[model samples]
Target: EAEAVLGRVEDVAGLFAETPERSADSPGSDWEDRLRDLAVRAVLGEPEQAAMLARASARELQATLGVDALRVMSGSISYVRRFWAHNLKGAPKASLEAWFEALTEYAVALSYSRRLCTRSVACAVQRERPGSEGRRLAADLAQRGDEESVDYGATCTDAYVAGDRVRSLVNMAGLPNWALHEGDEGAVEAPGPLHGCASICFNKGTVVLPLTDICRPRDFEERMCGRGKPCRGFAPGQLVRSLVSAACHPRALARGLEGRITAVDRTRGRVNVDFGGTNDNGTEGALRVTLLLSDVSPVEEFEAKLQSRREALGGFFVGESVRSLIFLPLQASRPLLFGAEGVVSMLDLQHRRVLVRFGGEEPLQVLLRFQDVCLMDEFEARLQERRGVLAGPLPG
Candidate 1:
């Protein structure tokens, strides 16, 4: 386990201590059992428990960060395995995502010969190709001495696939970790980085939800059509109007509220909006609020025409400096670029994306959807408080 630790990464054996310790006699079904088993196995000098614990950690990481975490975790491990590896002084040791990824790296190394990491991949394949699932895996891992070709791998790999497994559905909707936890798990309450977890125009604010609570925007409109409610989900960022009465939604003043769709919880047929001015008491700034999907109608076709006219103008005028509202949103002290300043370099009216050039010691240009950034004047207003550590954008 020490051999697997990279640079500042905590030793996999040592990092396991960060997780809650499990009771010896309890053997609970929850995450505690897995932690205890890992501890006992390490003392016995068997790596199998370590592998399983790492697997669980991997899945939980996936649950928090999304499926693309696999790529980042795998690539980080691969980069170290290469011939010209760095001393990796640049790798920060404190972030939660980095720590979980380290555990995954340890798992990947230990499971290389054992192939214990196939559970997620096999499940994804089975889901994508249920008609002919496991035909390849069966042949690849076939044992010569078996009486019949056994599908042992598929049994374990596909177990999580049969239910509403959160692992399999991690970030399928492109929501950040905070949204994945639905703002419940304080551990990942803020969006840490933009690697596996990308951002919507978090400037609009968001309502995190469960995979079961939302539906795909393109799926059939359920509650809306049934009651003359604004059914039929609109694309993210499109303008919408309220069709609901104050009784159904208090802030929605009987078909008065209007805002753009920041996100759609298509699973349970709801939406998370980024509108304001609903606060009557005006004690504090309004935050993201949830409303029934059927309760809001898309903005008028006249507004759509206005959008086309704006599109005719194409949404940019050469160069403008706007703050990116991703990663840490308003600002980030630790990650270097949260709420960082950038200048618009180009526009893609065809896709409505913009190219923003972020300035740093080494300049970087990124092409992002128009909504992911906020104009400078609006930046301070929408600017969320910096999450995580408090410091300047640059490292000392």
Candidate 2:
């Protein structure tokens, strides 16, 4: 047992007193049992317990960050296998979306493996140097060298795939001591590292969630309808209204900048506004700034006028006509199978879900986020080419 557990004869002394009068058999089998228990606690029990704690920590991290997923893994005394999840909160929209997709792909791969263990499967969202806002929360466990949180960011195990039996969802994978040998009773250390486990630590605010919660919904549409949020770029001569407060925009347009969008890159989330060569204060040569779907609201005058005209024309309901295309809105962190596009068979805003048909199928009740519901004719064909670039490739 000592050869299997302690690894070497010389190390056996480390488990008991060094006093010369002590006999190895003096304490009998009872004493040996106690020592064996100590070895098990130090070798296996402690690490499993740490993994349980790491799971809790991962949960806390998710709630605080609000990202789609944030997983952490820590090793046992010598074996490392653990994982947890969290959300990335208040992150840049592009990063948030990218990470969310990557995390989903990671989850899918795990499910495909058909194996379940608390291992980590990585789907990188791109490692970035935290922006000024993100740096404040950044921490590298290696730099701290603290004892209480010894396993906080240790990486002793290889990342792999595991899942819940009922859900068939894969979420985490971690490395274990390569030299571990399973015995009839439990695992026994063979010849390998004396101590150390896998460690991963992050410094970010996130909320904790179960790793399985991050998996993508089964069979989402591979092709997205040109519908959904207005991600199409504005023409150079097109006019747009600013949706942000004056403080957030360039100083020259304090009264609110309503100008032609000279340049726009929907992928980069940037826009250049030409206030027509010069302004009254001449304070604006041009305003090139970051813009998001939320930073640009519809022109109220145009929206209100359009609504009135539609209402006067009998009704203002979208998908009211036969063969109208409708879409379901993406949820926060949770992916849905049929949220992309469907043909409108019936329209009733009064009802919670709309009745829509998909590809010659019977009408199905589907919920649509008001924002996600858009007229199909309104979708730009050119924008479809850019969809893959913006949303990233489909999850595996």
Candidate 3:
């Protein structure tokens, strides 16, 4: 059994030497075909032939393609184990066991080979090869993991690994948010002039804002007590109470800001809101905010725009600060949705999706329709036209 295993190993090694030319003829072919061929030979009691095929495959991958076959093998251990499990039950016990042991050894060797390959690739890619796409590829792969985690690792912690170290350095040093200047007067102000409201341009290309009814303080209170509905002419008190109720309901708070319109921008179709004074630090300060709304469209499109901007702006590095802008669009009657401001971290443009990581941790993703962009120049133009009509020089 020992001699048989040794012979099989040697045969596999030899097969690897000749694989390059064979593989070149069928570019991007998977290894399963070669595995199956080896299996057939082995089942026919031609262990040497099976080994030879394996050897050639490994050799071709390494020599011709500059790939480390062993490293590739290591990453594939789980797959090999699965294959073994699938075929184990019906095989001759002793022979099957010996083959399994040999496969395990192969897996270990492959893993070590992969590690070396990964190191080699890292070095080669770093010499700043002309037209080297390594940096882009690395960035793409890094994004597959959690952005916050990657950000933290690359910035807060100094942990280094083969694949993550360079990316960590790039991300940490390249994307600092210099837009936010420390000791700036605006940074220390109590509730800076409410910047802007949120608005949405819908997929079908409509922009809408909640109806604004300014009333006396008493009228606002009556409306809230249900003595009056949300029609015009509620006393200011009724309006205020109703707004407070909408802004402060526990469920609304959970959905992010239930019932209040803190400020309004008719031209932008946006609202500056206070979500019942619950602050991020869990203190009782007003949650001064702006949020964008889309008319029943998925919030993803806006998210994509935000993520794309973040990447382009190099906004992901540590200490990089971003500002918030909210947009909201209203239909005749429906629940208002949330919008965003700050650093966008992920986007799926094909799907028109986006996710923003706010306050360094919380991530919000929204899907949006094409028409629901508040800042889109097309929509803004329409808004300006409407405003001009409403303000028409007081009919002199």
Candidate 4:
């Protein structure tokens, strides 16, 4: 639905706005313009930009995001190319090489690394919000070329179009031998890269498709052709955020909690998440909590938006006073964010934590924005009633 508002930014005054009857498909001529989906997703994940990411790439971002913000895109193509070579090594790669290459690219596109991620700016705002966070613009960006098609689309002809001398070699799914090799240079020659790829047409009209679509050749999973086995996606010991909402599913689990996966029980469709918050005798904080496989997602890019903060606080402004969350039990030798009041200093985007300058000569303590602190209003009652006690009894 965000795409519907593709050209809203220029319509800021809305003086000449169209009525509600306009069709989304023909919204604007700007839809014809495009940007590299690769570069757009790469450098766009930088701190302020990452949090402001709008999946529907809006044009307002174009006006606001300076050329400097997008400079890394040209170089980041190298990273994507590198990941492809390393990932495709030793694969059966017969006909489905195109699809496999797409997967690695999609995975890298969403990589948590700020340098390599693919999220794009949500609005045209300053690089960093000084006083407090605020609303941002969101609009539909161009549908990336071949990116969408590479994953789900793409026919045999999509790759080896015989006699079709194409200039660019970017997204073409040429065969392994035809793949761009090391030390290659200059503007790519057409048929030179096509090579033997064009001859596949005579092999009884063979067609290329995704492994999931194909039924045979040994289903792609669990040491897939001796390739790395996928542990149902979530690997043991990887950090995951609960998809459940505490308010909506109080009895089930809490949202925004980062827990490590201890074990995955595929037979029962369950996974054990270790939150380290156990009762004195052992419970939610102690023993591993079992969750349905669907209740959690990975935090490759960890940062929160205005919605992720406490609505009661009005706004999380810099220098705003704050207090730590109720002490929760933690792994031995791990630091606890549960003591004393502090002032909200700045957002430490690198660590994905809030740098709170606590009182006294002590240094700033970076606490998890979701679980470790709150506004000063009801601090006393929550502490007295023991309502928000997420962790321990507070070690004296």
Tens digit per residue, CA lDDT, model 4, 33-104: 222322222223333333333222233324444222222332343455566568668767663475454444
lDDT of 1 by residue, 81-163 (tens): 34222443355656545644444433323223122333433332112221122222223224333211332211112112212
* Cα lDDT computed for each candidate against the true fold: 0.43, 0.32, 0.33, 0.39
Ranking by TM-score: 3, 1, 2, 4
Q: TM per model?
A: 0.24, 0.20, 0.25, 0.19
Error of 2 at 281 (Å): 14
lDDT of 2 by residue, 15-131 (tens): 433534333233332322322332322232233322333333333334443222222222221121122123455678887676554443322222211111122112221122111
On a 0 to 100 scale, what is the lDDT of residue 255 in model 2? 25
Candidate 1 residue 168 Cα shift, in angstroms, is: 21
**Which regions in candidate 4 have their CA more than 4 angstroms from the true location?**
1-315, 326-337, 348-352, 385-393
Give the distance in Å from residue 194's predicted Cα in candidate 2 to where it truly belongs: 36
RMSD of each: 20.9, 25.6, 25.2, 27.3
Candidate 1's C-alpha runs over 4 A off are 1-53, 56-233, 247-252, 278-288, 301-396
In model 2, the number of clashes is 42
Error of 1 at 203 (Å): 20
Q: Write the per-residue lDDT of candidate 3 for residues 1-396, one digit (tens) a residue.
A: 223223364555466556663542355654445544544344233434444555545545556533224334433545655676687778899978877755544332332223223334333212221112322222333455523223211211111121220100000001121111101111011111221111222222212112121111323443223321222222212212111111222222222123344333333343333334455664343333333322111223434544554465333322232222234344223322332333434445655543444442434333333233333233446455545766742211
After best superposition, candidate 4 residue 18: deviation in angstroms? Answer: 48
